[model samples]
Target: MSLLNLAWHSLWARRGTALLSLLTIALSVALLLGVENLRTQAKSSFASTISGTDLIVGARSGPTQLLLYSVFRIGNATNNISWDSYQQITQQPTVKWAIPISLGDSHRGYRVMGTTNSFFEHYQYANKQPLRFAQGRALENTYDVVLGAEVARKLQYHLGDKIVVAHGLAAVSFVNHEHYPFVVSGILQPTGTPVDRSVITSLAGIEAIHLPPQQQAYSEQQLTPSSITAMMLGTQSKLQIFSLQRQINEYKGEALLAILPGVALQELWGILSIAESALLAVSICVVITGLMSMLSTLMVSLKERRREMAILRSVGAKPRHIFGLLLLEALLLSVLGALLGLLSMYLILAAAKPLLLSQFGFYLVLTWPSLQQLYLLLAVVIVGFIAGVLPAWRAYRYSLSDGMSIRI
Candidate 1:
């Protein structure tokens, strides 16, 4: 028989034990690869969400907190910087562009941000990639609103549709901006960032929505926005970032804070690193257990195959040939199991892509494995080869003893 056919038959000869071992290996491979892929993607997506930005200026607090609130929308801004300070910083010779952000409102659970038209022109994500509109232009009027890709898909919002805003970021809002309703003017393309899960409007629109306390007397007055949550500043020169930040920090006019976006992002990742590492460690332990199970099952099956080895030896089969047979069986099993596991992972990720994208703006790119993943697969294959060595060694030892008369 051909070597391939021989290996196939040998594996099928112990089909019950072999199938169980194969399954164990498949499970382990899937968990290891799946966890690694997710971890790598999450880190990359988080880091790439804001690129080409020099610094993020916000209220005085931890850098991580500033990034979390400004870029990721993970938490509320601790305080609001006055609109006057925002204007002062933007007029500097070193300042190129500034996008002011006003938060503290929501449609359903998605955040509502009021920013300038410069945001669409200047904001970048996924490695300095500019925002692209799937439909219509950026919001210009006080009542025009733009929906992010995820926000549109999840809430089933359409261009020209009118939606009311909640006073606070609440999923089930009771207090509403009943006076000023927003018309969906545009929908943004997927950016794989928090922007995809947000609603964007003009800073003026934000100003018009929340009127000053006295305007509440004319409760029927048209939208008149006043305050905002935070602002994003862009600079003309890279070297001027620190000096500008210092200027905002020392502003005696108002209590404020200015942070560098890159620094804040690093600190944010550092704070989240602990939880992520813990999850990976747990997944690794599970994978190790699965691998051990496969190894033990393979080793135990050798007892029943001892008689088969003896019969082959009695027929004058060489020790090396018998060892090759055992090794070939393991190689085939590992390859088949690995292939199946990879296929399953791909299918699962495919099905979950839309949901994940719309819910968190975390797009799972279904591309070929990166170099790191390739290296991981290579390590798995090497481990499989080593796993087969012991079984092959046992067969070799048996063949050396049995000399053409032994059937036991």
Candidate 2:
């Protein structure tokens, strides 16, 4: 029989221990690759959440805080930007278009944003892609509201369904504007971004809900909000972006912050880098532990294989052949383990795609292993070969007399 066939028979004889060792390596590789997938995709998601807009102008606050509130809807603004400030800034020669964002209310757990028709027309995501509607049309009246894909799906809302807005971010609120419910007019297409969780309404709808009750009728002139949470500004020229940002920062009317979304995203990632590194380190340690387990299995099986080695020697098999056989077993086990690990990873990702996109608005592209992942697989094979060196040497050194006679 060939060396490979001999190696296969030897492993099959010790299948229980070999299987356990293989599983350890497989689980370890899955964990390492999973961590890498999350890290790279998270950065890409955050960067593409909002694109095309040149600046995010919000109430004076830390750049990261502003970005988190304005774009991600993670937190509330420290203060509101007055309508006067929004108008004056947008009037600048360099300001090409602006989208106002007024926030404070919620329906269920989803945030409510008050914006203009400008938002539907100008807002972009995922490489300057325009927002698309999956149902109905944009806001046409003060009482009309648009639903994000997730919001509509989770709430089972459709056009003309009236939803009551609550005063705060809590899922269950006691102070609901039950008297000022808005009818759903449209549902936005899923963009796999944070916007999927937002409930959109016109600026007039927000203003009317908070205003004192009377003959509750609002017109286009009265649609102007008293203050807004933030403004996304687009500049006419890329060259004028810096100049416009500086101008907004130095404005005297109100304390306002203007931040480039890209810069804020980088800073946010920098803040999160430590946690990401720690996760990666832990994954590497797990992979090493798995390799160590395989080594231990090989070491223990050595003593049991002494009689088998004696028979091979009697058959005129050289010490070099014995060494090569042991090496081949280890290589085969690792290669199988890596393949199993890759299959498990893809299955997990496939199952998680819908949940991630719906709940977190995070979309992970399901693709074949990346170059970096391939490198990791290559590294595992190299380490597996190195792990076989000790056992291969020991097996080669065994003498024919060692196991020719049975021990009592």
Candidate 3:
């Protein structure tokens, strides 16, 4: 028989076991590739969210904390800068334009960010791309609101719908400001950032909703306004960022801090670096375990195939034929497993990309594996070759020893 026929027959004789082995290898490959892809895209997403902004100014806190609250909307701010200070900073000669962010409320688990129309004009993400409107425009009045793409899709609200501003971020609010409902004026296009999951409005709208109800008789009583959350500042000159940051940090008027958004984001990733490392280590282990399992299974099956090998020798088949059969089985099974794993990975990433981007500000690029990934695949093939060697070697040795005998 030809080498191809011998290899085919050998695999078919043990189809049950071979198929199981292939499945296990395929699953392990999928796990390794999936984790690596997630890690890479997550880092890209985190880093892309706040590009182009010079500084993030907020109440006193660590740089990472400020980034989490202001940029990622991951936590709450302890204090807010007064409107007077905000105005003073914006008037600086080095300042080009400023966009203040007032946050503290949420609509159905998404954050509410109150800013000016300038925000849509100036704020950028993922390669400095401006926020595009899917429907309508930015809010012109304090009573108007603009929903992010995710918020619009999730809530099913269209333009001109009335939405209530709650007292706090909770779903159940006892202090509902029913008197100051906002009209949905616009819905922003998807930007693959936390902004896509937020409710946007004018700064005054945030203030108005939080303002205490006034009794008809209390004209003279001083009103204590709710503190604003955070602000993102843009400058005319890139060189002025450090100076402005220093000024904001040293201001004697209020307890506040300012940071370069890019720097703070890097610091935040440093803090989360351990999680990334752990994921990488786990993937490597999975790949190693997968290769070992394939090797062990092939080696075990060789012991039972010795009689079959001797019979082939009696039928005038060369020892090289038996060796090629074992090696071919290893190559065929491994390549199939790898292809299946890659396909499964593509399907999963396609499904999860939108959710990942909106929720975590990560835009995953799904494409062929990178050079490093290709090298890893090549290593897997090399591992298969090594695994097949012992079985092929045993078959060759048996052929020389049997010498046409019908011995067991």
Candidate 4:
């Protein structure tokens, strides 16, 4: 028989132990690849969350914090920049287009962001992709609201449905601006970003909700937002973005922060470095444990195979052939485990897609294994080969006379 066939027969003789070892290694490989998947996908998701905009300007705060509140809508802003500052900055010689953003209210659990129609025209994500309406048109009236894909689907809301705006992020709030409920004029398609969970309204709608009941009747043209949560700016010249950012940061009109979304994303990722490292370390440890278990199984099996080794040697099998056979068995198990692990990893990701998107706005897409992940699997195979050395050597040392007498 060929070495591959012999290895398969040898493993089949100890099917239970071999099966367990294969599963353990497979799970380890899956976990290792899963971590890598999360790392790369997270970067992609966050990086693609906002694009085409050159600068995200907000009230004075940490760049990462501003990114969290303005783009990700994770937390409340420290303060809001004045609308006057917004107008002033947008008029700079290098400004291309700007969208004003106001936040801090919600419908049900989704964030309520206030901005002009400019938002629809200027905002982009995932390679300058513009927002498309699944149904209805963009915000056109003062009391008009736009429901994101998740909000519309989860709430079962449609165009013309009036939604009460709550004062805070709670599902049920003590204060509700029911008097000036917003009519859902549009629903945005899913972009796999924070926008998918937002409840959007015109800037005037946000301000109107704050006004007294008597003053609620208004035209958007007559209303001016006194303050806004943040602003997204597209520069006229990509080369002068840094200079404009410096100018915005030093603006005499107000204390503000200007951040390049890409750099701030890197900073946000830096904040997650510790957690990422911890997760990676834990995955590595699990893989090590799995490999160790395989090694233990191989070593224990060598004792039971002493007679088989003796018989093979007697049948004219050289030490080299014995070594090669044992080594091939380890290689076979490793290769099978790696392949099984890859399949399991993709399955898990597929199952986790909706949950991750719903819970954290993380959209998982299955792609081929990254080069790094392939190298990791390759390394696992190498380790498995090395792990088989002791048992292979011990089996190679077996003499023909060893199987002549049996030990109870």
Per-candidate TM-scores read 0.90, 0.96, 0.89, 0.96
Candidate 3 lDDT, tens digit per residue, 3-30?
8776777788899888887777777778
Residue by residue across 226-255, what tens digits does model 4's lDDT show? 899999999988998999999999998878
**Model 4 RMSD to the real structure?**
1.7
Residue-level lDDT tens digits of model 2 in 91-183: 999999999999899999899999999999999998999999999999998889999999999889998999999999999999999888999
TM-score winner between 1 and 2, please give it.
Answer: 2
User: RMSDs, each prediction?
Assistant: 3.0, 1.7, 3.1, 1.7
lDDT of each: 0.78, 0.90, 0.79, 0.89
Candidate 2 matches the true fold with a TM-score of 0.96
Let me know the TM-score candidate 1 reaches against the reference structure: 0.90
Choose 3 or 4, whichever is better by TM-score. Answer: 4
Q: Candidate 1 residues 1-408, lDDT tens each?
A: 765687898878778877887777777767767777887899999889898777777777777777878888879877887767777777889889888888888888888988878889899987789999999888777789999998898889999999988878779989888788899999999888998988998766766667753464432224433445667778888888899889888988777788877777777788889998898788667656655666676678776677777777666667888888877887787777777667766777788887877655778888887787667666666677677888789778766765554445
Better of 1 and 3 by lDDT: 3
Question: Alpha carbon lDDT of residue 287, candidate 1?
Answer: 54
Badly placed stretches (over 4 Å) of model 4 are: 219-222, 400-408
lDDT of 3 at 375: 70
